[model samples]
Target: TLYAVGDWGQGKGKTWTRAGGVKLAKNGNAYTGTTTMTKGQAITARLIKVDANGKTTWDEIGDVKATADKTKTVDLKWTNAVEDTVDITINAAADLKTGETLYAVGDWGQGKGKTWTRAGGVKLARYGNAYTGTTKVGKGNAITFRLIKVDANGKTTWDSAKDRKSKADKTKALGVSWTSGKVNEDGTIPDDSAISISGKGVADGKLSIQKGNLAELYVIGTQDATPSDAVWWSDGAAVAVSGTGTVYGVQTGTAKVNVKVGNQTATITITITIK
Candidate 1:
């Protein structure tokens, strides 16, 4: 019998029977039969021999590799199954520009005998806000990555200042959001400073609230010795705020609130989850 595992259904790992008793091939070896897979989707499977009384005798573990076509076939065969663990990894893709390229360097690559250039760097494919790719690395390996953009005239731009860092493991899915747009020509990173509301109930940069719930928007930066005039605005019709920065949630949806303190302006995102 073959069993599928790892995010097959929902929420982390899940197991499902992929095949019953394996079919006997012409060479007498048992095969689990072909399993169809998509281009970017990955799946890990384990083969188990079951006795008549419903007990597993032997097991062999393996993973399916994605192909270039829209679909791929996977079949598992083992003459002598053994008990062991096999780690399967599917690298994530990022949403980025068309002309730009993503690269990863650190203990996972450089320390492992790879350079930090376009030829030696680990390249990631653009997948709509994510750059996805696959690499084999031991657990707990530290990694850092950067982006390079080359123009039509052969000029190149590098976003080396804001390299993202993470550890290599199943628990850590590496991802970074280019919320402030791409890197500039001079290599200076863009500022992503914005106003945020923090208090009793808030998570993931979003302020969750019910209808008629009162929330406060806090200024994130240090104020000057002299006070400046502050103005506040809300994009959603259901959201309203007083002059003192107290916000009231009137309906369910997302509300983008903007605050201007003298020459500086910042926006806060609020989500009205319960009406």
Candidate 2:
């Protein structure tokens, strides 16, 4: 409906007018009409949308100038914008290793579409079994994002969903996934890049052990449930992974192995003292 909003001599008030009504679309889907309540004066146009059952869906107002049969287009702007944020969680795929990196990309955070600055760096922190990120969108708009993994060798792995190339861009968020591996609930370490020189270091990214008989290098990872997938990696032949991180310490005296259980990196350098 149209209303004349001006000094009507009665303390400047607005009243109903029969000059015109907002016209609906041809198929009765949208509003597109004009009014001539008061020529050369400002007209206050109020449009109300209702459902088939007469339930009010939307109600907005717009001010337009009507001058001597001139139909000025009314651009209605809704003041009640959506102000809720969305929480997106990714239960990262398995096969993740310690010392590697997992990042979120494609516009999930303030990074424009990235969750971090570099591919080898992780910004979205992982908790329990999920990597959580956040974003805000309009009522009918969808959010987009994808997962990225940077391995020990600096190789990247994108989200392996739907051709493994498309970012998750949708309005619905409801799903589950598996973890990189499994963590010992009793693992003594508290953060990434940590190793256990027979349970000595916690959150420290480095440690050492002895030769032959000191053959075991156990990594009791973070206090949180992290994947113990860091390979039994080492430098040259200073030590060999006996399918269970067994050290030889016979042929070589120095070795360094890089691994991680979360975002940080841990390097285990063994300074073997020959027996």
Candidate 3:
């Protein structure tokens, strides 16, 4: 359940009134409520969610168009406002253009993750090939993010590397080098997948296919790390992943596949679950 309230004006002229009850919708992760207000009130409203343990969270409602004696359905997604500080750095040498800006899109459930938007990206300051910025977050929250660069014209490109996860808090600067590929004659770099050395075991321990099914696993690699040679094999299945990094689920149980890329080899534990 959610508690709703409206606040208007301030000081002596301030007015506060109860909005109404808000219940969880059928789809879940959403709330619905009826708020009656005087037309053109210009009032600000908020919701306080009361959880099972009686712990309550506050969320402010965004702009909503309300009519006199009419119903309005406002959709909201919870976001912890960014208040923490952290530095981000990226290294790209394929000429990322002068106006292109690199941002770190993150918050894999660490701290309040609503800091970045697809329209504007992360709020990082660009310095040459690196970016520096910070957002205030709850203390000791683990933050994981991926790097994306946006050109002035709004064109965007993501780094080929996986999420840069950190155990320590953001007090320590975040850094990751670019895995950009060669530039084409049109002054455009290849896509992130093109730069990746397929089957770098990106999904190692992640997955491929279910039982009696075979699917190809993609490797997420950087340009600097060209793990060209890969040998795939399963522990018990007669079929194994060849140079294609494709695997088959021969048994209904779990199977472990080994991918040896250059000197480094990663073991992918696959659960052959067929629905």
Candidate 4:
């Protein structure tokens, strides 16, 4: 329900209330109105009483402007407007290139939440409901994502990722709000829910696979465990990856060994220190 009248110039206006205690104001070049009522009170404006069922509803009444004569009063009558909530969905894939915007939609009762997309993604959420945030991959050595939410007034907020148990745990926790796109208020990209590419490298700066001069691959993380059972590959003859982390190269030339982990791949160089 929208109305327009007069030559509503540009960028400069005042807001006020008028008629039937209908607080009105000129937002830039349009007339806006609001009411004061308890919950369950249907909003009545322009001969229409819109109900607020915990959802965002909106309808334009009409537009009015201040006459050049400086003698104009635009007043409207209706129900009050309260904050509502709605569900949103977002789906994004890894390896995303720039300029890819995430689509967001909500049931803004009336017709608000039209449609919006940000190339880098936007953060949104209800105060006590859920805190969520989103961002695109930026230029950084290691970048992490998290979801955050704020109140209707755009103040007071929370972050779901900050309270995550673990990277894997965050994945499961954030998958709930996962419609096709709307991720949970928590920032969690799981190996299964999301895509990932894991790569392996030998800091020794030598081709351990190519030379086949090595026995097998070991994952001596921060701990000094002889982690056996790791996959051992014969060679990259058929792009075969070591099931665990061990390999039996064919003592070949310089070859780069690699393994796949979900959406990521790991690679290692074998110099084949052939004696």
lDDT of 2: 0.40
Cα miss at 150, model 3 (Å)?
Answer: 1.3
Superposed by TM-score, candidate 2 places the C-alpha of residue 33 at a distance from the truth, in angstroms, of 38
Best by lDDT: 3
RMSD of 4: 27.4
State candidate 3's TM-score: 0.29
Sort the candidates on TM-score, descending order: 1, 3, 2, 4
Model 1 weakest lDDT span, ten residues long: 82-91
Query: Whole-model Cα lDDT per candidate?
Result: 0.46, 0.40, 0.48, 0.30
Off by over 4 Å in 3: 1-94, 108-116, 119-121, 168-170, 180-275
Ranking by lDDT: 3, 1, 2, 4
C-alpha lDDT of candidate 1 relative to the true structure: 0.46
| Per-prediction TM-score to the true structure, in the order listed | 0.32, 0.26, 0.29, 0.21
Q: Top model by TM-score, which number? A: 1
Across 1-275, the per-residue lDDT of candidate 4 in tens digits comes to 33212223322342221223343343434445433334332222332222445332333544322233221122333332221221222222222123322222222122333332223334443222233333332112122233333334444232332321112111111222322222212223333333221112234323343332223333322111112222233344522233444344444455566544334343556555444
TM-score, cand. 1: 0.32
Model 4 TM: 0.21
- Model 2: per-residue Cα lDDT over 1-275, one tens digit each: 32222232222354533233444442123233333444445444444454667564334334333233332233343442222442333334334688666665554333344443353233444543344333343333333445566788988776655311112222222222232232221222233444333222212444445554334344444332112343455765665443234444545466676445445555567665655
